[model samples]
Target chain A: MSGVADDTAVVVDQVSKKFRLFHERNQTLKSAVMRRRRIVADDFWAVRNVSFEVPQGETFGLIGRNGSSKSTLLKTLARIYVPDEGRVVMNGRVSSMLEVGSGFHPELSGRENIFLNGSILGLTRKQVTARFDEIVDFSGVETFIDQPVKNYSSGMYVRLGVAVAVHTDPDILIVDEILSVGDGAFIEKSRKKFLEFTGQGRTIILVSHSLPQVREMCHQVAWLDGGRLRAVGPTDEVVAAYGASIEAESS
Target chain B: MAASYARELIATRELLLNLTMREVKGQYRRTALGQLWSIINPLATMLVYTLVFAFIFRAEPPPGDPSGLDLYPLWLMCGLLPWMYVTRVITGGVASITNNAGLITKVYFPRMHLPLSVALSTGITFGVELGVLTIALWIFGGFPLPWLPLVVQAMGVLAMFATGIAMLLAILNVHFRDTQHFVSILLPMWMFLTPIIYPISLVEDAAARAGEWILQVYQLNPMLHIVEVFRALLYDNRLPGAVESLAAIGSASVVFAVGYLVFSRHERRLAELL
Candidate 1:
């Protein structure tokens, strides 16, 4: 709570998160009791002493290979996983789209899901109600809005989900691999929305494997390698270093 | 910190209300009877109990009744409706956290609201069941109109109790999947321990044979006091003593406090665990 700065949107002060890699998941009562002994070797640090600052109005990119803790860092920033060490401070309200359609109930209609998803993203019901038509229009699923989302095509599902999510009006948005949603046209539309959103002085942390998109959209970039911060700076420099590393590894 | 917690809860009141609405709506969706099944479920169970206990076994209602209705079906319902609510809340709540793994892993909110909203949604069904019970009573000339206020108080206390237990079980089920199966097994045993179909007076003979502490320990079950209060108000049309109602409320508060503490302690880790 102490790190309050006007220009900083988010601060991760040496944050670390650890996970227990149980050889046998001790979820069952018999195993939990039988193997009460703890093993230090199984403890894995997913985010290790990673410190960075995302200034207000910046679109930050987190880039790494699959097991490099990029998503875990974003999850920590979302407060989905509390940091084991240090702290994360945010200057404004934070919302995350870690996965598209994260909270959509298949049984619920698109209209119900709008309210439900909006509330999940921390928007009040009145806010969702005010933007209901806009959301439905943006998703372009107004024709089938009353039908259950389970019946919608996968493209329609992600379209509605992303539409509701982006409209949450968050000061800082954390998105992980959400750009890979929907068909070509919808992805283009979503990219446009992301640019417009960042233009309004909101901060975004984008986590994706698409290097070209990251290079295009991110003003600042942080590269993580094996749960540690490898390099962080302007997008071009870090992306060059990240690209060179991938080339070196592949060679 | 507790003040801030309460303030945070108040600030997120809309999420709680919407989530509860979602629970209530999603549960009965696509069902033939819709939400009427909420009322009919308990009503049918009450009739089944009435047939087996009242007619076949000839179980008597508690002897001392000012309103003098004392019918067995009415007696069974006085306790059964609240019992159903409690069980629903616990069973539903234990699954609430695990069931919404997608939401918990992706978004952040006050996690306690999940179980609390589940309990509240079940309370909606409890309300419908109580209304059906009242109408049924009127049809049978045993409507406890004068005791409506007391029934309201009983519902509040019962909800508090159920929410507390639900919160505790929900968190526990997250850490230990066995807690889910454990609770499912524990519920039927819990019902028999409480005097839903029979009166506490029936246990008097057992207390005499065993010891006085038998009944005292039985009364220690919070559900017993809740059932007793409901039975007194709904079946006998009499007000329970001040001490009795206060004891039920106090015990409920204690469970709720403990449950809240445990839930808050583990709530943050739930995202990682789930």
Candidate 2:
């Protein structure tokens, strides 16, 4: 945990995000009239007063149950949501693999999506051109690069997404369970590529449900439960504590 | 702040270029004709209109004589060409940001780039139509007008104004989905209200006492003034005076500023809304 304080690649200060939950979407006039006053909605804080930092060139893991603000925190870091309160200051170019193939056009070929994905990740055309062959080779989809992405298998799609993202050489990489998408072999390849990326002195923020993977990759870890941080410290200790807390609750 | 914004836009130029190309290519990907459909669609529509209006109504005569030149096709083409471009930009531009909800939600770039890319892509199709129109005119013996440069300048002015409106509608449609429906209904009605099929002279003659007022109100549409400017340049070989041009420019600039403000303000929330 002290290591996070020393290098501080990403700083989250009292960050909070509030969302309006609409009970009735009320698209039609009939529905609008039937809807009660105040419109059956409430303000919900998806993330509240969350503050943490990842050190430069260190792998940090966030573990939580579903709807525990794990993905929301990554979104806040990506600048997708302007925090309702507090500030999130990131020191370098951030690339998020929150959803693989999220930006890929179905009609476009695998080759086109590479350029499209690369551009979305802030790589210039020249940069994408330079690494195009490497990306295709890494994905092992060189034979199907010219085919439309819609026809590609789910595993192939994830492989291409991972390949493009790793090739971006992002300063801070935020990944959300991307490894869970592919098969064992592809996952092994992806893990190797991720290790190579981290070896180049890049900061990584990973969110995963798999405890062992987290413990293996992360130098430090944070546990979030119900939109609040439960614990933050060295990976092994925090994971042990989190596991114990869960078992104790279930029992 | 403006300088920084301009620099950011410039920095994203390559992204914009690639995105715009993607829009153009992605549009007709599985279709048979692909890009040529851009030209063929409008040309086919024009032919249908020409046959119906010319043959049925016998409204094929030029302004003065039937044999002099068939001004009907030229008039219809002038208005239809620009109107097609404007309507496309309006209808398509609105969905530019909303349609790419995934990109907006996942990544961060200048949000304005999305709508601007749609406008630029549509503008390319419009350019091709314009080229085809020029060729048709030359073949018809309309040749080159004395005010060719002025016509080109006016077209430039109109494009700027159209782009500004496109930007505004794009942003508005994201916030209020009604804008999409409203634009669909509004465009054809707008064409009817403008002096597209008929001449302004006919309006002036019919209105008699209220001619000036009606024309003035019509001028408020901005596109009407743009069309008039286009006609004056291409047909009459003269540009509208500084006063009218300035008024058109001023209105377009205002639309642009308002659109920019709305887009930038709500852009951060687009990922959630979409």
Lowest summed lDDT over 10 consecutive residues: which window, candidate 2 chain A?
A28-37
The docking quality of candidate 1, as DockQ, is 0.84
Tens digit of per-residue lDDT, candidate 2, span B1-274:
5556668889878888878878887999998888899989888888887787666755532342221345677767766787787788777777777788888887777887887787788878887887787667667755544656765665566665666666677666665566678878988998888766656665666677766787667667777776666555444334566666777677667777766676666777777766
The residue ranges of model 2 lying beyond 4 angstroms of the native Cα positions read A1-6, A27-41, B1-3, B57-70, B145-156, B209-212, B241-244
Give the poorly placed runs of model 1, Cα more than 4 Å off.
A1-4, A36-41
Candidate 1: deviation at residue B155, Å? Answer: 1.0
| Cα lDDT listed for each candidate | 0.87, 0.78
Candidate 2, A103-196: lDDT as tens digits: 7888999999999889878899999999999999989999999999999998899899989998989889989898888889988888888888
**Lowest summed lDDT over 10 consecutive residues: which window, candidate 2 chain B?**
B60-69
Q: Write the per-residue lDDT of candidate 1 for residues A1-251, one digit (tens) a residue.
A: 56467888999899999998877756777776677655323889988999999989999999999899998899999989999998999888998999888878888999998998898889998899999998998899999999998999998999899999899989999999989878888888888888888889999999989999998899999999999999999999999999999999999
Q: Pick the TM-score winner.
A: 1
Candidate 1 chain B, run of 10 with poorest lDDT: B62-71
TM-score of chain B of each: 0.95, 0.87
Any residue pairs clashing in model 2, and if so which?
none
